[model samples]
Target: MDKSAAQNSAAFLYPPIDPFDQRMLEVGDGHTIYVEQCGNPAGIPVVVLHGGPGGGCSPAMRRYFDPAQYRVILFDQRGCGRSRPHANVDANTTWHLIRDIELIRTTLDIPRWIVFGGSWGATLALAYAQTHPDRAAYLVLRGVFMGTQTELDWFYGGGAGRFFPDLWARFVELIPEAERTDLVTAYHNRLFSGDMLAENRHARRWCNWENALASIETRSPGGESPSDYARAFARLENHYFANGCFFEQDGFLQSNAHTLADVPGTIVQGRYDMICPPKTAWDLSMVWPRGTLTLVPQAGHALSEPGISAELVRVTNTLRSEAVALGL
Candidate 1:
């Protein structure tokens, strides 16, 4: 079905619900992330990971699961959303976030749970599941991003620019000619330039570039993100991209796909996902013995897209029946 027709069809997401528990979790390094729990308190556990490394969880995120069956957990990564010291990137790394996830699990007394994430969140879910394979019962990922340099080059470099030259030109025009060669580094310098005004300006452009290409339906550039959100999202994203997502080696997830040999996973990818194209998802499915990849036509990177949301809800609903068999 076309994007509009799919959107007009029945809503795929479950009904919205408030969190049964919420708190500020201190996970060291002077950072405390916001954690919230929704759905059945005694239901099977499922942790939701938001994208952007800095993208905080939202109310819509809580609606993907069946409230009567899955105990949903969502949290704002360090330096974003309701987390303390807003926009601060100190001591934040891929490994640190993994540690925080474990801390949340242990604190809540969850033995094992489903790991659901998309975009950068997919990157974290893979890292976390690989690090603590035993703790991950099953994996549901969308808009797969492996945090590899090639993937980074595709979006920040001229790869995605090839398709959206108009938006790309606007994004590139912000930096001088010499700095254009390394857009990520150039943006990093400005985003952390200590001038809040300059930072916000560059941050909006940085976020606008990504947001413009987030969905298949977004043809024109959207309005500027709020200064606070744009600052956090751009800074944290740039920080990670500049540092190669804090990985010891390139293609870390692919090399370590063996760790997930026993863990089954489902990857829902948009066929036209410009921010995180489907190639990475295909590569991951190839390496992951039990992984399944579902390519959704007329879809892009945004989790809210009709086709993407429908597939995700279908996957989550299917998993609900198998929860008992999986020992959830």
Candidate 2:
């Protein structure tokens, strides 16, 4: 599609709406997370999980669902966005996030609700649903990430680098020759180092590497993210990746696909996604039984990509009619 067509298709998002309720919920481990509720209070409940393992929710995320038909819940995971103790990874893990989701659910009195997520968010959604299968009414996932070592290797271990040699070089050039072999660990060391300047410098490089590859339209590495956002995003992401996302084993989500056999889902993937490739989404659909995978041609990985945003909105709009059937 041409630039004009792509810009026009971007209008798929619902009209902007303000949150009717917002607050900070203390989720233990000395952490407090920011949570907000938008749209109809009595409408079907759907929680939005942002990516990065640290990428906090944004107002645009609230625009994906119709305000009159759904209650959208968005929160910043521990140490990111409005969440407290920014950039600190202590006591943060996949399991802690799942517990926080449960806490939010029970606290809101939502017996069951639709789970919407993408990228790392998709990883959490699957883990959360499988752990508490009865709490998920349905799932709307995009850019599937299973948190396996192979997936990690593809992105950080040079598989993706083969395709973007220039960006990969920029990403690795900062580290010493000996440390170039494991960029994640190398970046992890600096990201956590006590020197704020060095941390922020490395953090920007880490984030830029991912951001440049996020969209296919980009001709350059793009601009650096603000130091604060970069620190949180890079640190939390590297922390999770270095630890294998706190999973019991690689392919944990895929091995447990049976748990979601009865939970119907829709996976929206980008045909050219460099961040979370489409193959994982395809692999997921094969075992999910009830899951439907929709690949958006010519799109890359960003949530704002026109094709991706259009399909996600289309999926949510279609699900509105099924709210009653889903026991929303």
Listed per candidate, the RMSD to the true structure in angstroms reads 1.8, 1.6
Q: Check candidate 2 and list the clashing pairs.
A: none
**Each model's TM-score, in the order given?**
0.97, 0.97
lDDT of 1 by residue, 1-328 (tens): 3456446423888877999999999999999999999999999899999999888999989988999998999999999999988999999999999999999999999999999999999999999999999999999999999999999899989999999999999999989999888999999999999999999999999999998999888766778899999999999999999999999999999999999999998999999999998999999999999999999998988999888999999999999889887779
Give the total clashing residue pairs for model 2. Answer: 0
Q: What is each predicted model's overall lDDT from 0 to 1? A: 0.93, 0.92
The segments of candidate 1 whose C-alpha lies over 4 angstroms from its true place after superposition are 1-10
Please give, for residues 1-328, the per-residue lDDT of candidate 2 as tens digits.
3476447555888877899999999999999999999999999999999999888999889989999999999999999999999998999999999999999999999999999999999999999999999999999999999999888889998998999999999999999999988888999999999999999999999999888888767746877899999999999999999999999988999999999988999999999999898999999999998999999998888888888889999999999999889888
